[model samples]
Structures are given as structure tokens and as C-alpha cells.
Target chain A: GAGVSQSPSNKVTEKGKDVELRCDPISGHTALYWYRQRLGQGLEFLIYFQGNSAPDKSGLPSDRFSAERTGESVSTLTIQRTQQEDSAVYLCASSLGQGLSYEQYFGPGTRLTVT
Target chain B: AQSVTQLDSQVPVFEEAPVELRCNYSSSVSVYLFWYVQYPNQGLQLLLKYLSGSTLVKGINGFEAEFNKSQTSFHLRKPSVHISDTAEYFCAVISVSGGYQKVTFGIGTKLQVIP
Candidate 1:
């Protein structure tokens, strides 16, 4: 893809249900990131992936939130037993990783609304 | 731990008016600074970055920011803004941990350019 891409641009799920947001980063990119943007707030770091190394999960708000990436390609963010407060836009980004400028290319985020 | 702060929650300005959005961060070690913009219904786009260079960094759409190490701030500004510039702006910092990069974001500032 020419740019980062995300699936199910909009999602409506009931409280307690699980949701998975997908991200397809640019080809050959070695780093991927996941972030959350609440209404009227800034982007919040969730998780990070660098090649095949263990992901940085320090930003996950709780045990309900998890993310995984395979090799240097697609990534998935799964939220278990979603809460109303979980309503926000989930964004994904990719970068060239170390040895280059750390500018991240973002996708059109998935807006999840838990009713 | 690294953290970021955006002083202003919202700022309104008339078209063609100059504007500045304030951002500050706290870090124990040298870090990479960045500014990102998010238009309505879109994902974030990197505006500029300060990674060991001149303090003044220029970005797309006539945006610029000055990285002040003393004050620990990176403020975004535009000589003149257009209605299209109405969007949410975020400040971020990249900190290296165990050979991997960890990004932290501040509470965003909404720039509303009135027509």
C-alpha cells in the first residue's frame, strides 16, 4: 500500500464485547505503533512493535487491551470486555525503524463506539 | 518515565491570523521531539521533528516549531492559518529503551481557525 491502512473505519459494539482493530503498515516498514484518541483529547500510546522483537506493552491501560504483530507486516489490537470509556479512535502507524528518521506514517484510525 | 503536556486545550483564531500551540515534555535523557496534526475524520500526520538539528524545524502546510531544551518545550506556530488548518495538534517525544523506541504523547491542542 502507498500509505498505512486500517480496517472497519467505524465500529459499534456493546459494552463487555470484544473488538479487534487491524492495521496494515507500509511495505518494508520495520516498526509499527498503536495509539488511542479519546474525544477531545490527544493521542495516547498503547503499544509498539519493532521487527520481531518483543512488543513494548507498557502503555496498555489494562489487562483487557492487547496487541500483536507478525514479522514486519499486519498488526491487530484486541480489547476484551470493552467498556463505555473505551469509546475512542484507535490509530495505527509505521516507521522505517532505527537507522532512519523516526517519522511515523499513520492510518485513518478506527472509530469504536461502545454503547 | 517520559511525559508530555499541552498547555492549551483549545485555541480559536481568525483566518490568516498567526497562532501558537504550546507543548512541554519532561525527560531525563535526550529525546526526539515531534509535532503531529489530525484533521477531522483523519489520522495523524507528522508535521515536523527535532532530532539533533537546528532549533527551528519547518513542517508541511506552513507549520513550524522551535525546540527549546532549556524550557523542555516544543511549540508549534504558523505565520498565518487557513480554515483548513482547523484540527487537533499533538506533541510527542521518542525515548529509547533497551534498543527499542517508546513514544509518549501529550494532551492535544485543538486549533480552530474561524472563517
Candidate 2:
């Protein structure tokens, strides 16, 4: 892909249900990131993946939030038993990851609405 | 730990008018700074970054940012803005070591360029 691609531009799911969001990073990019944005609010860091290394899951809000990446190409974010507060735009980004100056490229984002 | 703060929630400017969006951050060590813009229903796009060297950094869309280490700020500025500039601007900071350190984002400031 020419850019980072995300699945399901908009998702409307019932509360307590589970949803999985996918992110396909730019080709050969070694770093992938996930972020959450509430309505009219700041972005909250979720997780980050660097190649085949262990992902940094420090920002996952709870145990219900988890993510995985394979071969540093595609990643998936799963929110189990979603809550009302989980409704937000989930954004994925990728970067070269070699230097401190690598600027991330972002996807269109998946807007999730919990009802 | 790292965190970012965007003081203003909204800013309105007339077309061709100058504008500034303020951002601040806190980190224990030297960090890289960045500014990203999110247009309506789109993903975030990197506006600029200050990894090292000069404090001033130029970016696409006629946007620029000044990295102030003393003030712990990275403020985005434009000499003139267009109606198309209406969007949400976010400031971010990450560790200089890189590698999956989740970038912390500010709350974001909505730039409204009015005609």
C-alpha cells in the first residue's frame, strides 16, 4: 500500500461486544503504533510494535486491550468487552523506526461507536 | 514517562491571517518533538518535527514549528492560513532512543480558518 491502511472506516457495535481493528502499515516500515481519540479530545497511546520484538503495551488501558503484529507488516488491536468509553477513533501509524527522526505515517482511522 | 499538553481547544483565524497553536511537553530525557494535522475524517499527517539541531523546522502545507527546549514547548505557526487549513493539530513527543516508545500526544487544537 502507498500508505497505512485501516479496516472498517466506521464501526457501530453494541456495548460489551468485542471488536478487532486491523492496521496494515506501509511497506517495509519497521514501526507500527496504535492510538485512540475520543470525541473532541486528545489522542491516547495504545501500543507500539517494532519488527518481531516484543510490543510495548504500556499504554493499553486495561487487560481487555491487546494487540499483535506479525513480520512487522500488519497489526491487530482487539478490545474485548468494549465499554461505552471505548467509543473513539482508532488510528494506526507506521515509521521507519531506525532513527529518532522517523516521522510516522497514519491511516484514515476507524471510528467506533458503541451503543 | 512523557506527556504533552495543548492549551487551546480551538482557534479561529481569517483566511490569509497568521496563527499559532501552542504545545508543551514533559519528559525526563531529551526527546524528539513533532506536529501532526488531522483533517476532517482523515488520518494524521506529519506537519514537522524537531529531532536535533536548529530549533526551527519547516513542514508541508506551509506550516512550521519552533522547538523551545527551555520552555518545553513546540509551537506550530503559519504566516498565512487558508480555509483549507481548518483541522485538528496535535503535538507529540517521544524518546530519542526510539523503538516502539509510544509517542504521547497533546489534547489537540482545532484550527478554524474562516473566510
- lDDT per residue (tens digit) for residues B1-115 in model 2: 7889899999999999999999999999888899999998777898888888989999999999999888999999999999999999999988855444657889999999999
lDDT of 2 by residue, A2-108 (tens): 99999989999999999999999998899899999889888898998887888888889999999989897889999999999999999999998856347999999
Once all C-alphas are superposed, what RMSD does model 2 give against the true structure? 1.6
Pairs with steric clashes in candidate 2: none
Assess every candidate by TM-score: 0.95, 0.94
* DockQ leader: 1
Model 1 residue A48 distance off true place after TM-score fit, in angstroms: 0.5
The parts of candidate 2 lying over 4 Å away from their true place are B97-100
Candidate 1: CAPRI quality band: high
- Candidate 1 lDDT over A15-86, as tens digits, reads 999999999999999999999988877888899999989888988999999998989999999999999999
TM-score of chain A of 1: 0.98
Clashing pairs in 1: none
